[model samples]
Target: MRKGRDSKCLGSIIFVLVFCFAISALPFASAIQRQKAKIEKHEFGELADGIALYTLTNRNGLEVQISNYGGAVVSVKTPDRAGRMADIVLGYDQPQSYADDTVFFGVLVGRYANRIAKGKFSLKGVEYQLAQNNPPNHLHGGVRGFNKVIWHPREVSRADGAALELSYVSKDGEEGYPGNLSVKVTYILTNANELRIEYSATTDKETIVNLTNHSYFNLAGAGSGSILQHVLRINASRFTPIDKTSIPTGELKMVKGTPFDFTRPTVIGSRIDQADEQLRFGKGYDHNFVLNKKGKELSFAAEVYEPKSGRVLEMWTTEPGVQLYTGNFLDNVHGKAGKFYNKRDAFCLEAQHFPDSPNKPSFPSPVLEPNQRYMQTTVYKFTVRGAGRGR
Candidate 1:
């Protein structure tokens, strides 16, 4: 009877041990289940006109929060080397603050991504005037650009990823731009950890269009700290310098021997404060780099590395220029997690035509005539330093 009792006790102990192992494996199982590609739509509150906000998440854990109002990228969550995920873009946690967002955050910039000299541009022999939102010049579309309006979103699921296609029709004379512009922008989150932005537009009349995503990224995680130590590399040997009012001076200045040089990998803060005239004008590295392109195709534009987290971001685009704005204007602004964001907290790489291109005849024309299509593609690919397949 004692031997029989001993056998029963040994069976009970084995059962307990097996149960504990299964319990410990629950979290891992759940994570594995999440790795399958899927898209989820969450109710992200409403805009003034009852437009809804939505967030899309993929199976690989790439999450993109967006609002129909302005088609803004509210946030982007990506994983670092340790497989720990964090929001790497700067913005407000609550969607309401975005209604009056002045810094642009992750909004879609357009009609023109940069500035227009003195809010004036002559197109097709007609001088057009725009709102001087940036004081001496017209900045980012106008006083009420695409960032300040709602869009119609059509959700689509692809074989490898999911996409949110946002459409908007801007009536002629809106924001002083002459065109009934119908624009379609698709934001795709792929299983390969890529955030792809595809823009297309057609105008009923001749008009200028330069679209880009204004996302301030900090690979160390948003609002965690400054991105001063982030290593940056751009494939451009030339950059467009800005004047006192932050408008491009229409000259493609060589970046060699200047603080603007990023041809070789360099820390962002290494020469940011150097006694250079261009650096002083932008308060940092706020200039448009002329992308080196061999043909009219997508090519490597820039790469940023955060050593602390081993997070690396590679930008590929078909556009000819990329505006590198080093968060120079962010100051004392409250962001996600109740964190205060200051200057140099993040950086933006906006892929588009050169700034003030409408005024600079020598620059690539941003004009779209009747029956002509405007299309631009930009991809932000994320990876860890030692990730074999570039994530």
Candidate 2:
């Protein structure tokens, strides 16, 4: 009887311990589940044809919505210091709205990312003339650039996070260019809260190519208000000054005493309204800063911090220059969620070769040879201030 009682006691103890262990593991399992990345696709309405919108969610609940219509980053939802999630990119509610968007919102710019000087450039003694969409200069490819077209998208399997790959082919003479350029842009939302954009291209003939994403960001949340309060820092000692026509003067001017200086963290509105020539010409900041790079490798380009939200954005790029556009021409444009985006409502940090590189021999070359491949990588990492520091 004594032996039987002891055995029963042991069995009861083992059962109780197992139950407790299982209960204790529940929260851990839940956490692991939460860390799993996911992607969802939905129809984003018709624009000449059916457009698909993909939402990629990272491990930490960060979500990015992209549309195939223009490979536009429709929305980027991230958590603030208080753990409240909000969309941080400006965009329209419908795909058709993007068709008429002039501010470039969050689209993939290509062919030649920035201006091309009176829509003309000579390559190998052959001069090509493109559409002059922006008056004397040809801006963002042409009238019908990559940002206005559809792209083939496929979901890529990635261990770190969710990825979406978009491919497009710009035929020879499509935008008055001389080559059939095949381009691929991959957007990966890694578990570490980074949105990595990888761009690769191949051409059948020698041509100039500079591609970049023009995403107007308001770290305080899209449509919240102006971005003047945001602090910005650009890793650049010199910037390419622009002429009255918004073309780079081919002079790499120092940023030390100019309103363009952003070597250290400074409020965007501090000197933006100063009576400066560059500011007046652009109506605000709209020039490219010659990035301080040691080599042709990815390096820190810029950082933006929003104090109210305690959200910080760090940009790393392989490109030699970054355009710091302050949305000077926003003009009370209607945006997502019935919001109106005014001038200086947001900013764009476009990582690419200097503008009009093909026309300016002194600038870094944007040419891509037939036998060579063009590749560029840019990462936008997001984090809250004082995160994980027991703040």
**Best candidate, TM-score:** 2
Which candidate leads in lDDT?
2
TM-score between model 1 and native? 0.89
Q: Taking the tens digit of each residue's C-alpha lDDT, what string does model 2 give over 1-391?
A: 9999999999999999999999999987788786778889998977766589999998778999999888999999998999899999999889899999887889999899999899999998999999999999999999999999999999999887999999999999998998999999999999999999999999999999999999999999999889999999999999999999999989999999989999999999999999999889899999999999976799999999998888989999999999999988988898998999998999999999999999889989999999999999999999998545321
lDDT of 1 by residue, 260-318 (tens): 88999899999999998888989988889998896559899999999878899999999
Query: Model 1 Cα RMSD, Å?
Result: 7.2
Q: What is the lDDT of residue 383 in candidate 1?
A: 84
RMSD of each: 7.2, 5.5
Name the runs in model 1 displaced over 4 angstroms.
Answer: 1-34, 387-391
Q: What TM-score would each prediction reach against the true structure?
A: 0.89, 0.92
